[model samples]
Target: MAKVEKVKKKIADIFDLPHDTVLGLPRVTLIGSHQLYIENHTGINLYEKNQIRVGVHKGEIQIDGEDLQLRTVYSDDIFIEGKIFNIFLKEQV
Candidate 1:
């Protein structure tokens, strides 16, 4: 078997240490709801450590995380926030 190399996507590498590269991933700031079509997104920091407001309005998806050191958003439909130590998941009912 050939050794496979893990090629981190251009976008996924931006949030890593030493922000010297512009990977595909970018800091998104959405005013209203926007239909997102993402395949392999590395990290998403909605806002600073302020607050996040996400919802579906008029057939649009909105994500808002303000004043917080936000992190990864997985393809499995999960939200990641806070430092790894003080992280928790909340069920959106």
Candidate 2:
């Protein structure tokens, strides 16, 4: 944690955000105990060995795992759950 604290000031000014704000806020979003979807996500960071798995298509997504989960949905949402071994996105007809 000391490593993070050391650069706290430089990080604040570089980002032009409040100093404590960065430390104060939680970066994770759209989270549930077993599922989560982070908005504005460009890349994924895996913490555990098999926490989640996802695949992207033209406009659809599929996730899988033993205890896969999702936090919430957009106005356009679809939910499928099972012992998901595969997910294939379908184009709108």
Candidate 3:
């Protein structure tokens, strides 16, 4: 890891804070098989009925589903609804 990130991890561990939250990483929450909530997202790269790509700190998030709809979107949070089947992360170039 980068020096800054290594230090950040150390700090988070020492303080007992959530590493992702303290280091400003994306937080994804899945509800059953139908909904998703993302926090600390930068923006959406692509949106479609079956897929979504969201920009995050060092990469992007990919969501695969059916009849996908953005239930809520904000500067740092997003809510998606559908028959969510898969979610993955992709490194940005």
Q: Could you tell me every candidate's TM-score relative to the true structure? A: 0.22, 0.24, 0.92
Q: Per-residue lDDT for 69 in model 1?
A: 38
**Candidate 1 overall Cα lDDT vs. reference?**
0.32
Candidate with the larger lDDT of 1 and 3: 3
RMSD of each: 13.4, 12.3, 1.3
Superposed Cα deviation of residue 26, candidate 2 (Å): 9.8
Write one digit per residue (lDDT tens) for candidate 2, span 4-81: 765885788788986435544212223243434433222322322334333222223334455554444343232323
| Candidate 1 local Cα displacement, residue 63, angstroms | 9.8
lDDT of 2: 0.39
In model 3, residue pairs whose N, Cα or C atoms come closer than 3 Å (at least 3 residues apart or on different chains), thus clashing, are none
**What's the TM for model 3?**
0.92
Encode model 1's per-residue lDDT on 50-88: one tens digit a residue: 443332211222343333433444652334343222222
The 0-to-1 C-alpha lDDT of every candidate, in the order given, reads 0.32, 0.39, 0.93
- Predicted model with the maximum TM-score: 3
- Candidate topping lDDT: 3
Clashes of each: 15, 0, 0
> On lDDT, who's better, 2 or 3?
3
Give me the displacement of residue 21 in model 2, in angstroms: 11
